[model samples]
Target: MNSRRDLLKTVGAGMLLKLIPVGAFAADLVKFVDVRLWPADEYTRVTLEHAGAIKYKHFLIENPWRMVIDLLDMRLDTTLKDLTSRLQADDPFVQQIRVAQYDANTVRLVFDLKTEVKPEIFTIEPIAEYKNRFVVDFYPKYPNDPLLALLQKEDPMLREDEISRALRLAEAETNGTLKLESGSAGSAPNTEVAKTEPNAPVNSKPKFEVRRMITVAIDPGHGGEDPGAIGKGGTYEKNVVLAISKRLKTEIDKMPGMRAMLTRNGDFFVPLNTRVKKARSVNADLFVSVHADAFIRPTAGGSSVYVLSERGATSTAAKWIANKENASDLIGGVNIKGTDAQLAKVLLDLSTTAQINDSLKLGDAVLGNLGKVNRLHKPRVEQAGFAVLRAPDIPSILIETAFISNPAEEKQLTNAAHQQKLAEAIAKGIANYFAKNPPVARTPLT
Candidate 1:
C-alpha cells in the first residue's frame, strides 16, 4: 500500500511540472529582436527593438570619448551581437560598438566614439509594425549653424556682386529715388534705380539696395524610420520625395539671388517641430515640404498641394491626409522626454492668418505648375492643419508629388526624367511667385 501511494505522488508531481508555462522562466529576460543604426551629419541614431520593456542605464566617458549602456535582466544574444556589425565607415559619431555579457543577468554595450558627443537616450512604446524600442542619439557637442553652412556654399565673387547690387538698391530706396517694376516672365522683379533728380550725377557713389539673399527651406517629408508610405511595388515615399527635393534644390540653386536649404540631406528622422525650427533659424522666406501621397485604393492618383488652415481642413480627404501626416512623430519614434515643449506650444498657439494668406498664393502658383507635370488631385490647393506647415511667420506649403499607391504613378515617381520635370515645374512656380511678390528686405545686405 505504501509503494502504491508513493507512485501516485510521483505521477502527480510530474503532471504539475508539465502544466506550468514553458515561458515562465524565460519571461524575466527580455530578448532583442532587431537593431538599426542611422548616421548623418546632424546626428547618429541607434535603435534596439526588443520583445518587451527593458531597464537600462547609460553613461559617457571622456579622455578618449566613449558611451556605455547596461541593460538589466537581458541576455547578450545573436540579435544584440549583430549591433557590432552595423557601424559604417563614414559614421560621424561612433567608431565601433562592443557588446558582451557584463554579468549573469546584464548585457553591456560600449560605443567607441570618433569625437565628443551629447547623447540622448530614451524608449518608445510599440506602434504600427514596430515593437518596444530603445533609442540613442549622438549629437555634436557644438552643433554647426545651418545658416552659416549655407552661406559658405556660395561663390565668393557672386556673393560680393549680390551684396554690391543690394547695397545700391538700399541706398537708392533710402534716398526715395528707387522705382521697382515687374520683371519679365520667370525673372525676379526688376529694380529701377532712378535718380532723386534727373540731373543727378551718374558717377555719384551709388547707394546699394538692402535686399538680402532669398533662402528657401526645402523639406523632404518622412525619412529614416518613417517611410511615409509604401506602394504595392515596394516604393518608399520617403525615397521618392527626397529624390524630388534634391532635384528641386539643384534647380533653385541655379536661380540668381536665391539659395536652398534642405531640412534633411540624408535618410534620418527629424521631428515636425524641429523641421519648423530649422526653417525659422535660417530665416527662410518660403517653406516647401515635398511628399508622395498614398491612399487605400490603388486607383487613387494625381498630385496635390496643401497649406495651413486655421479653422479646419478644406475637405474630408484633406483632413485624412493631415491626420496621417501628423502621426509621423509616433512612427518615427520621437523621444518624448527630449522634445522641445516650449517650441511645440509656440508653433501650435501662434496665429498664422497672414502666413496662410501668403501660403495660399504660393500654393496656387505651385499647383498651377504641378498640373503641367501630372494630373491634379484637386484643381486648387487644399488646406489642412499639417504640423510641419505651422510656422507662423513663414509661408509654408506641402506638395503631394503624386499618388504613390497607384501602380502607374509609382512607376513615374521612380523615373529620373519625370522627377526632373517635376523639379523644373516647381522651380518655375517659385520664380513666378517671386516675380509677383518680391521678398521684402529682412536684413541689410552684408
Candidate 2:
C-alpha cells in the first residue's frame, strides 16, 4: 500500500511540472549597479547600470518639458539613488532629476528639462567594464549647428591676439608657462605676437585683410566607456592621444589660415559614427584620428599611419587591426536596434576613391614627419577599411603614434616631452598636406 502511494505521488508531481511554464521560479532580483551622467554640447547622456536585463519604458512629458523613465521588475538601490547627485548644475538640457520607488518592483526617474528635446533611450548589452545598461540621451529639438558654432563673430581686435597666443602656447608648454592650457579655454588669450604672416590667402571672395580658416578635425580615439588599449604601466591610450591631440590643436590654431576642431574636447565617449559626423558637420577640410597601438607581444614598437582602403585591407595585420577598431561600437555600446539613417548612409555615395587617394597623400605627409620624431612601424602608410576614415568627401587619416605594448615605447608615449614632440610632428605634417593640396570649397549639403 505504501509503495503504491509513493508511485502515485511521483506521477502527480511529474504531471504538475509539465503544466508549469519555464523560469517560473527564477530569482526576481535586478541589482542596480551605478549611474553615470555625461553632459556635453552635443548631448547629455544618463546611464543606468544594472546586473541583469532591465525592463524600462521612457516617455516625454510636455508643458514643463520633462522625461519620465519607469523601470520594471527592479529595485532602486543605493547606487542608483545617487543619480540625482550625478547631475551637474550647468547641464545644458536637464534642469533637475527626480527619482523614486513608484511602487513594488518599479522604479521611476523624472528628468526636468529646461527646453524641448528629442530623447533616445535604449538598452545596451554588457561590454568592457560595464554591465547591462539603460541609456537616455537628450538632444535639443532644434540642435545647434556645428558649422554655425564654429563660426562666431569675434571682435576684430581680438583675432590677431588669439593667433599669437596659440603660437606662444606651444613653446609655453615646454617652458612650463602654459598657465592657460586645455583647461583654461575661456580665459583671455595673451595679446603678445610672436609673428604674423604678411600674405595669407583670403578664401571665398573675402576682400578684408583676413584669411579663410581651414578647419582640421583632430579626433582622439576612444574615451569614457571605452578606455581603449592599456599599457603595462597602467597608462590609457585615450588619455595619451587626447593630450597629443590638444597639443596638435594648439599648434594648428597658431598658424595662419588654419584652425583645428576636436571631435571631443573632454574624456567623453563620442561614438565612432558621431566622430565622423562631427567632422563633416563642421565642413572640416581634413580629419586626423590619433591613437596609440598595442600588440600581444611586448616586442612591437614604433608608429604607423593608415588610410581607408576601398577594396579590402592591404595586409593581414591591417585587416585584423581594422576589424578590432570597427568593434568600438560594440565596446562603446551603441543603440543597435534604433535606426540612425544619417549614420547608416554607408559611404556608398561613390567618390570614395578620390577621398582615399587624398587621404593617402595626407598619410604620406604625416608619416614622413612622424618618422623624424619616432621609430617608423612601417616605411609606408598602410591601407585598411578604418570605419572612422569613411567620410565620403573629407580627406581622413589615422596615426598610431607608437606601440604602447612595448615597455620602453610605453614609457615614452606617457612622457609629456614625447607627447609634445609627437604633436609638433603631426601639426607639421598637416601643414605640409595643406600647402601642397589646398582645399577646394564645395556647395554646402542641403
Candidate 3:
C-alpha cells in the first residue's frame, strides 16, 4: 500500500546501512612532511607569515645560537631542499644543516658545527598576548668541553636508551655481571658525589612506622607539542601514556591509604624539573614515571623498569628511555646553551648515588607488582640516568610499560582493558611497597 517514492526511499536507506562499516567515520588519514639536510650560511634572511600570508616579524640570535621565525598558524609546506638552499646560500655560522622529521607534527633542523657553540629549541603557543611561532636551534658543538660534556652526556642525543641500559648495568653491577665504565666517566667533575652512597644500610627499614596519607607522583612522559614515541599506525606516545597514567591514577585513588597526583592534568608540556617539583610539592612518598618504549628496530618488546645511573644506561631499554626523556628539554623550552654547564653537571652528579639506590628499591617493588599482572622482560631491575627521574631526595622509577614500537605490543598497549590491567599492576606495586616499608610520617596532606 506504500507509494512508489516511499518504497524506493526505504530501500535506499536499507542499502546505505548495509554499505557502512562500524567506526568507519572515526578514522582520519595521517599527514606528514619530509626532511633532509642543508648547508649553512645559505640563507641570509628568513621570514614567516600568517595564515593569509601576511608578513610577521622575525629575528636571529648569533651566540647561544638560534633563529626565531614567528607566524600565525602558518602551515609550513616547504621542501627540505628549499630549507637547504636558503641556509647554504646565506646563513653565516651554519656550516651545514641536517633535518629529520621527528613526527607528523614536528621537524628537527640540526645546524652542523663549524665552531664551538650551544643551542636551545623552544616555542611559544598561541595565547592572548602572543601567537604560535617556531624557534630554530643552531649552536656550536663543543668537543670535550667539560660542562658541554656533562650536558651532552645527559643530553638525549648523546646517550640513547640510557635509562634502560643504565638500569640493566646497575643490576649487572649489583649481580657482578658487568662493570662497564666509560674512560672519562670517573674523571667527571663531581667525582666525590658519584662515589658517595647513602649511609642507610640495604636491609635497614625506616626507624618509625607512623601511619599517614602517602601521596605518590605519577608522571606520564611526553604530551601536547611533544609526542614521546610514534608507532607504525600513527598512535602517539603522548596519547597512549596519558591513557595509562589516568588509569593508574583512578586505581590509586580507589586505594584506601594512598593518593596519586599526575605531573600534568591535560595535553600540555611539563618539564623534567617541573615534574620532579610536582612530586616534592605534593610531598610525594614516591615518584613513578610511566612511559612506552620505542626503538630503531620494531623487534624490541617486553616491559622494563629503570632507576638512576650516573655512568650510562645499563641495558638497551634503559638507553632508549633516557634518550626519549632527554628530548623533552628540547621540546619544553630549556636552552641547553643558556644553562650553567658546571652547575647542571654537579647537581646531576650529586643526585646519582642516592637516586640510584632509591631507584633500585622502587624498581624492585614495581617490577614485582608488574609480574603478577603481566610478563616482565626479566626478574631484575635495570638502571639508566633518565632526566625525569632525577629528583634528588624522592625515590623515582621510570617504568617503560611496554615497547609501543613493537607491532604486537602496540596492539596490546592500545587496548583499554590491557591498559587497565597495567595500571592496576602499578597501583598494587605502590600499595605493596607502602604496606611492607611504610614511610615515616611527614606533614599532613593539604
- Which candidate number maximizes lDDT? 1
Q: Which of 1 and 2 is ahead in lDDT?
A: 1
Q: Which ten contiguous residues of candidate 2 have the minimum total lDDT? A: 201-210
lDDT of 1 at 333: 84
Give candidate 1's whole-model lDDT.
0.86
- On TM-score, the candidate that comes out on top is 1
* Tens-place lDDT digits, model 3, residues 67-129: 433332223355433565645434445666545554543444445444444444444343222
How much RMSD separates candidate 3 from the native structure?
21.3
Ranking by TM-score, best first? 1, 2, 3
TM-score list, all predictions: 0.84, 0.79, 0.54
Compared with the true structure, all predictions reach lDDT values of 0.86, 0.80, 0.61
Give per-residue CA lDDT, model 1, range 239-320, as digits (tens). 9999999999999999998999999999999999899999977779999999997988889889899999999899999999
> Taking the candidates one at a time, how many backbone clashes does each contain?
11, 0, 40
